[model samples]
Target: MKRAFVPPADALIAFETAARHGSFTRAAEELHLTQGAISKQVRQLEDRLGVELFRRVRQRIVLTDAGRLYLHEIRGPLLDLTAATRQVMSYAGSEDVLNLAVLPTFGTRWLAPRLGDFQKRFPKAGLNISVRLQPFDFGAEPFDGAIHHGDPVWAGAIAEPLFDEEMIPVASKVFRDRHDIATPADLVKAPRLQLSTRPLAWRQWFDQAGVAADTAFQGSRFDQFGMMSEAAINHLGAALLPKFFVRHELAAGRLIRLFDISIAQRSAYYFVYPENRTLRPVVSTFRNWLLEEARTERTDPETMLPS
Candidate 1:
């Protein structure tokens, strides 16, 4: 007969809390227990595990080498357990919820406007959105799917093509008028706004325009398109922005196209989900709806402006 291995849940919890806070008093306050009680629980856990988990340093406590390793190993599982419990509780009286990770700017500026139609189409299905700045492990996180930008190269997920992006040089009217950028060569003189992710954007743009500008590498770098657009609008510099993202600003005359030329991005946006995980009905419905929406947007004359 094989013996079952189970540690004391209460003691483990107490130890984890004390290790995290680095003080039994703080952990006890958080757990709503007496400091002595927390210390006793941790001592019991350490005895059972046959290892010292913490080092008493004056009035404070710090994790030992074994303690740090144990914390690292248990944190993910603890988070998963909590998320799973909350998910079950949430679904007790409601429809199935689909958790999706999306880019902050893209979700706000583009997807947010179309959510009403999605809700109308699937009134019974619930949607949850979280901002995801970069690629992450789908297995570790509780996301059903994600809206990802760049290449379809997520290690464990299936990447479905959303749309390709076309970027163009844009600047505020004030900046454009001040610089008098009549040609691509003249654009080299203006301050260039760079995106941190696309370090080679300016260099590529200059190459495509058949202009040599050593200053392409020098400029204010931003992590998000919204920030870069705002800077451009404030007359900070000229920015290379996706046409769709800046369509509203361009129409409102807040920004001006410095030239008619556009650079087609190599990588397109994608809808990604783990290949090993089963696709729920709600997630499938959302995927289908999103793809159709993208198709409609692509074919619409108003949405597809002339380059």
Candidate 2:
């Protein structure tokens, strides 16, 4: 029988942090401990395990072969332990927090307002929202749940669709004043705001609308929809924006749809969680509530309109 193995949780934490960051100083900062303390704990772990975990490079630390092997052995368990502890603690508290990763625009305009009902029903369930850009990788990140738009085939996760997102061409009132975009030919003369790396948006929209323009519709490109929306609102150029993200702007007349043409995006928002994670009581509770909300959104019919 292998000797029963045991290590202090704190020491394991220190080792895991140091290994992940490759820096005792960074581990110390994260753990709120002195560098000497972190270093000592790591050294002790190595001594007890009878392995040289790391080598002292000129100034930086490099994982020794032993250290690399140990990290591979221990990293998964440590991360799982941390995640389980957090989920349990969240359940134990009066504030039931659901850490959600969402698209910035949709979280603000679509989900945030409606969350009030979720709070009312489960008053204890508090929501903590974080932003995730498109093409997010859930594997490497420490997110409990994510709302994104894409194919639902994330490596080891399950996706629940919220709704299909449609985009419409929009611009500030001021932009229309300066340009003659009465027709698609005229639109070519104006600037086209680009959002992220979605390359086929302009061509697809124009093609669907039975119109075409200078294939090189040019303007400033933005990595986030929020930035592109701002640029459009500021009279910079035309942006194909999702109605759900800018319902307020459209309702308040801050933005005007240049045309009623809407395109069904190949992707839509989804709520995804890792299939392998141990679902704690809190995680289950939050997941149940989110599914309920998605169902409500689907049936309400009225929610489909730009509010």
Candidate 3:
């Protein structure tokens, strides 16, 4: 295996601190080293990397273009390393931590609500969840598993089916009152909101509603479902959202169901983890628990529809 062009930790730290303060003297003070030692460390790093990290203008030190870019790249990894070290140091006993990356809305709306039950089932298994917009490298990121939405195919990972998307139309009561939304077809005429990720959502809903909406694809686009739901609440446009996302809003009457229309997306959500982690107790426990929850998930059809 080829070795990476990496410098010593002290050298990297010296460069980073110097870059932050724009002075070797300040960096030395922060690192509890002499100014000359700080200068030597930075010089060593620059020579090893074959890049000029700083250029002195008169008496003032300023980062070269390459220096600024390198600092930006390493700052995050450095912080992450420190955090990881601290996390390990804080471990009390045999308790294991399961790091997870999850779709933001899915985490907020679905997984979050059920986590209490997860804790009750396995009190010792600790979970650390971070919001993710899409699937990422399980090998690169420090994650035990992820909740994903797409096909059941991920490199170096096993995809376990969680649930399918159940979509419904929703609009603010004021927006509903303003528009003559008498039929499912009438929704095609009203202003609509779109989730940028799920471009086919509205079109699929219209097709299921037996409406020929050529412009179903046209609308105010949003990147997140949370934003789309809020836009609908404030009367931006009608939005097609998953039942999980708007359960509270629909119940609270903040957003009203437009009509008795629905659609199940072709793709479903999944619990994905690295292949080598299959036998790990935490991974298996969470996967089995989540799958059971998905199977039992149901929305009373009558309650979902307004009479």
Strongest candidate by TM-score: 3
Segments of candidate 2 deviating more than 4 angstroms: 1-96, 134-143, 277-307
Scored against the true structure, residue 286 in model 1 reaches a CA lDDT of 93
Q: Write the per-residue lDDT of candidate 2 for residues 99-180, one digit (tens) a residue.
A: 7788777788788887887778778765557787754555677577888777776777888787777777888878877896
What TM-score, computed on C-alpha atoms, does each candidate reach? 0.77, 0.64, 0.82
TM-score of 3: 0.82
Model 3 spans with C-alpha error above 4 angstroms: 1-8, 24-59, 64-77, 86-94, 299-302
Query: For model 1, what is the error of residue 3's alpha carbon versus the real structure, in angstroms, after optimal superposition?
Result: 8.0
lDDT digits (tens) for residues 192-231 of candidate 1: 8999988888898999999999998889999889999999
RMSD of each: 4.0, 6.1, 3.5
lDDT of 3 by residue, 1-307 (tens): 3346667778889999999999999999999999999999988888888889999888678999999999999999789888888666644553777788998888999899999999998988878788886778887988888998989988899888877888889998899889877788888889999999889999999999889999999999999899999999999899999987898899898999988778888899988889876557887788889888988775345335654
Candidate closer to the true structure by lDDT (higher is better), 1 or 2? 1
Error of 2 at 121 (Å): 1.2
Model 3 residue 53 distance off true place after TM-score fit, in angstroms? 4.5
